[model samples]
Target: MLVEFTALHWIYVVFIVLIIGFMVKRWDTSLISILGIFVLAIVATGDLTAALSKVFNSFIYAITELLSTILIISLIVAMSQVMKKSGINEVMVAPFTKLIRTPTLAYWVTGILMMIISWFFWPSPAVALLGAVLLPVAIRAGLPALGVAMAMNLFGHGIALSGDFIIQGAPKLTADAAGIPVADVVSASVPLVIVMGVVTTITAFIFLRRDMKKGTLELVGTYDGEKVEEKSENLLTLGQKKFFALLIVVAFLLDVLAMSLLKLTGGDATALVGGTAVFILLLLAVVAHKKKGLEKTTSYFIEGFQFGFKVFGPVIPIAAFFYLGDSGFIKIIGEYLPSTSQGIVNDLGLGLAALVPLTKEIAVVTLAGVGAITGLDGSGFSGITLAGSIANLFGTAIGEGTATLTALGQIAAIWVGGGTLVPWALIPAAAICNVSPFELARRNLVPVVVGLVVTTIVAMFLI
Candidate 1:
């Protein structure tokens, strides 16, 4: 059966296809393609006023919904900067270096550290910390900087950010679109995340082993100035080390307490992290620049915001176009698209469901593949809106048992696009390690591809 395409549907398909082409070719900025979609939507509706309204309203609505989360991310970044300036970040990772004596151990250690920190603070801040501290250690331990980057990308961006069990941002986004509780999405994501994590990590290890065998392994700092030499004397004063250690321990405990007492999840959890970061920043800044006072504190915050925007800004417009596909966002776009009971992505998915033979196994693979492909645009969470809509539509068309299939698709899409497979997503990590983003992406290719394959298989049997 051929799916019937409405004018609106045709517009969206063209927009999505063109965007995908732009990404594959690296022709122009994604922002240009996104703007083109906005123009196309307006032209389709044939209303200048409506298009103008959508331009302003849609951006406002999208920003407002995400404002708190964004602010929190900025704050946490700022705190990381403070920690770096204070030498606390180095102190934090120094102990771990002793355990990561070899290249292979470096990969696993970096992955584990990324996963733990990302679960609490989100991957963005986690990347900064890892890059600044653990990266040098891994490099010194005979791990390639590119390899260190891949490990961080897979564990932090792919595994931790994808499941978002602690912060709940990813699941919350999917659940909101699915019309289900955030807790339900979180519960469903746990097993899928574990499976993906194990597969991706093991695949990465295999590659690391081959590199080791070839004697191609180089210390991470060979290309950069990040090598850590073992000093006979501790560089930091004993009092300073003790104070920072207590500070780190207290901060971690506060995060746990906040998560437990406030029951914060998703955006709220991000806020908690960000708030704690600010508190830490203030505490550290005051100690470091007591004479400079509030002016220095202000500068630290500005620096943090700069980092946050640098990391997240490029994806905003891309997110805006996808937001147009949702019903909640259609009104923001104004009368350009008529209000229908169905979301654009949902309508399209339902149409496909009618034609496709969505058995249990087929459903899982199909959804996961579609999710991963949609994420090719490089904004991982942006695809969840599409995945959720598709899941709901196709789940109904196939069987009630397909909810997990939908969730699986959501997970795969974000995990891959969010930063794992995309060069753009790994920019901070690459920049910090002074490695090439494209090469880092190449390093991640096999592991992420194998992981996705394994994840789909696991989802089929488990879900």
Candidate 2:
């Protein structure tokens, strides 16, 4: 169907273009998003008072939609902090360092473990979790600090965040935007993530070897030709260490078993992670610090909430704007305006269906570009709604799989803004590895660019 546009549709189009322009200029979008909602609401409601109410309602809607994700991330971080303090984290990974005595082994093993942990606990927590324990080991193994950083960066942020299979945060955002089920996007993301992950890590490994051969493997971080020890402050006994480690493994294993038997997925699975983290925090606190456990537990809550809200702050306004382009339109404006012809961005996107002669290749590449552009603000997720909305538009236009296209945009956004390309976003991994964020971004450019290209091409076939 050829879509017809109204004055409201035109306004939304203009707003979208302006939003992209602001992002391209590397400006924060909170003001622009709020302004967009203000103007869109005023025009839609035809009442200044009613329009003003929408701005607040929109943010509340966005927050409500995202609270579960924010909670899970915070809880996981708090759980990780306790694990680190209890020395369980060090014990958990100690066995791996014994097998990582060579540069190549150090690179592959660290990268693999980082990916696995990042998938479960997220890169924010996993960086400290993996880096503190494994970083010195990889460096002591004659692997350059730069090499270790690249391995951690690509596997954790690039591969794990891009797919987000365990957390489902990235997929859920895009899937919601595309008007599809989260499970479908997760299902479609596996192959694309694997393709991107394999190609990018392998390509990065080749460059690491090439640099090593050229004697460029010198430490960029703190390593200076001396043996290093694990960075730990906890003094737990060996038996205590093993016990906590075992406790953690069993807890998560039970969660896994529950998921399979209960058919838990998406938000349900995420709730399990969050709830388990909270329980772990309490148990570990009591076990590790005894009388000080109460104080430490409260402190963990403070740290986790601070970090969670900080990340959530930048996203709320941005997501509020796009949520209006999805189901949020009705929720935010329904009291005053009963319905919309279609969601604002959706209308704009679908209206262009016939205007642009889109082949599968063009559609995939364009959506990927949109996804990358949205990531310029450096939060992989805040921009996902746009990617999902555009995928839905393109899918409607071309008679293809909406989930596949949505997954493609999701991977692109997360890989870039999630930490691979953006210097500011790469700080966690870079700081832990003691390398410049700029250099890490520079190292990642080639492999990530190639991987995105390969993945986008593969998406053409799938779509």
Candidate 3:
């Protein structure tokens, strides 16, 4: 099957190389994306006004594909905000404090608990809880704040965020890019996520142990018997906290049950989760504030939107560029497109297939590298739409589940920019421990790199 190389195909390759180049230099991708759209549009249509319209339309199309995910994460973030204020979030992790009498226990326990809480609250709210309550305890246990940061980084950002089982925000982005169902991405990523999580967390723990043994980690020295206590003034009562936590657990259980019984996967399942978070949020608000719950909940919604849109803004332009190269282009600029009516990336992938004999191993590794490269911008979610797009491109070249490739890219993008490898994203956790974000990222480098490699290998076989 011989395919003729065209100017559009060459343009696609040049833009891709440029995108990766900009990423390597850690430049903001929004500008590159918009520039790519203009150049590609001009090459394809040669009309200035039409090319510019296509750029905005590409952004509109990408936002349409991403709106649901953005809303869900926002809703979950709002729920977490209320949960934290009400004290429901605290009750879930307070029980674990009794088990953290030793540094080793403190390190592993904090990571495990952070993973659990972040699974539900989506990390932002959980960071506050962990920092205020857990960090002091970990420090008291003689684990250097840096060690604590490493555990939280690997488990919360690397593992839980990579999997994103509860919220499904990450999977939705990858799936949208790959043009696959979110459930498929989630299902395919299970093995890879677990392997990545286990390998990275374990490897990090080994390093921490060595550092502790060598007394390389500065110890706070003495274990303080003084306890850090949460103020009960604004917090929910113990009964209210217990009841709300139980309520959330049962609601999630019902969601899982409904998913299994009704065979609701992907969007449907995600809707269920988002709707459940709203329900719980409303219930807790009313229980805590009665009629004023509505007013207070409104503020939470505002906060959630702020967080969601701030993150969403960076990714929109990036996603728009990738969308131009995928199925979304049809919606963006239909009549203006050439008669071929094929995606730019899919076309380039075909060209690659003709030009190079890339094996599955080589293709998977390349996709993984592309994913990591995208992560260099340090906002994990924004870069993944590109990963999803690239996964589709590679999936065409190599016969594998688009979900597998997409998930691999998602994991790689996240593990890097998600917080572990990115200095800025780690600020929340690092600030909590009063350690340097650069050091947090540095400590995370080896383990996360190993995890990415191992995860990519496993992803290759998931076909």
Candidate 4:
């Protein structure tokens, strides 16, 4: 079937072109692109009277709908920040240093830590903590900073963030788009995640081993060759340290209890995590700076919000563009299509499906490859909605494991875009480690690509 373009469709195309061009040229802010799209949509529909209303209405709606997930992310980030200032971040990774005495162990430990914390917190915050604490240890153990970053990126942002099992952020988005239950997506993703994780980590290890043999390791320290200052220790008082430790333990225990007792799933679980973070933040601010009064308390929260926005702001417009592909948000454009109409990305996928005479094996590989290529634009999660919809369309025609195949696509997309192929996403980690982002991307290319290929093959057979 030929896809017809209405005025709204033309507006979307124009918006995408403008956004992509701006991103490629590094000429426009994400906020500008997002507002541009909204404005264009309103103008296309010739609804100036409603345009003003939509400015506030659309943002409010989106924010409200995503409030639970965003709050959870913000709280987790704030908690990690608190831990960093209190020295718990150092303490948390201190024991791991002993265990990761060798380059091989360093790679595994970095990957594992990134995965665990990224699952609960996020890769952005996890990168800061991991780079501050674990990077030095890994580098001193003869691991390259490049290798350390690769491990963190592939495991934390690529695999863990893509799966988002603990927080359910990525899976929730994919599930919502596919009109599938979040539990179903999460369950189906387990095997796919295992395949990708094993393949990616092993490939990264191979690269690390090769680098180690070459004796190209660089350690993180001051100019005089001493370990970096123990910034964390000097930042907190003794009482503050004790209080944060107790608070962390209580927060974690409460999380476990909430998950167990309430049987919270998806957004509910995310809200529980966020709520706990807020409670801890409040407690810490009160106990630590009680003498400063309410002004200090407000300042801490403002700091938290600033941190959250800094990390997550760039993602909003990117996400908004992808949201255009979702059925729920399409109505906002005010152009109704037939019930049989497919979103633009879905239409593109179906077109590919038609042209490619793919067997089950070929289908899985093709899907993975396509997803990875799409992710090259530098937003990992951006491709999932497209990939998920396509996977459902194509996988259903082939056999019984559609969800698993869909998940394979999701993994490839995230592993590539999350940080491995893109310098933009690697900025935080690279800056913290004092490494070159472009070089980090170069080092990640081979291992991550090889891993995605192997994982796709494994998933083809298993799924």
Per-residue accuracy of model 2 over 199-309 as CA lDDT, tens digit each? 999999999899998997565485332332235556467898898888887888888889889988899999987888899899888878888889989999888888888
Query: Which candidate comes out best when scored by lDDT?
Result: 2
Residue lDDT tens for model 4, 1-463:
6555455555655665565455444453466546755665576556776665555454554455455666677677766765666576666666678988887888888989888878767898788777877887888787777778778888888788778887887776566555467777788888778877777778767766876687765555222222232256355676657656666766777787878898888877877777777777667655555675356556656666776566445545555555555554455454454455576445544554566665788778867875675566676665565566556656644545567766777777788777777887777767766777787787778877777777887777866
| lDDT of each candidate versus the true structure | 0.70, 0.84, 0.80, 0.68
Clashing pairs in 1: 139-220, 167-266
- Model 3 C-alpha lDDT per residue in residues 1-463, reported as the tens digit of each score: 5455567667767887888898899988788888988887877777899888988888778788889888988998888878777877667677888899998899889999899878766776677767667777888888887888788888888889988986788998888778788888899889988999989899988988998899887654232323333433365779878887788877888888898999887678779999998988888877787778889889988988898898789988888887777766667756444566457777766766777786778878977898898888888887898888888887877656677888888989999998889898988777766677787788899988888888888877777
Worst 10 residues of 1 by lDDT: 225-234
lDDT order of candidates, top first: 2, 3, 1, 4
Give me the overall lDDT of model 4: 0.68
Answer with 1 or 4, whichever has the higher TM-score.
Answer: 1
Clashes of 3: 0
Q: What does candidate 1's lDDT look like per residue over 1-463, in tens digits?
A: 3454567776776776676566545454456545755675576667887777676676666566556656766776677666656666667777788889888899888888888878766787777666777877787778887788778888888888888776566676566556566677777777888888898888887887798679775545234434332222233465775687577668877887878898876666666666677777777777766777477789889987896566556545655666666665456654444444266666666676777766777767767877887677677765665566556656666656445765687778877778877887767677777777777788788888888888888887765
- Model 3 alpha-carbon miss at residue 182, Å: 2.1
Name the TM-score of candidate 3: 0.92
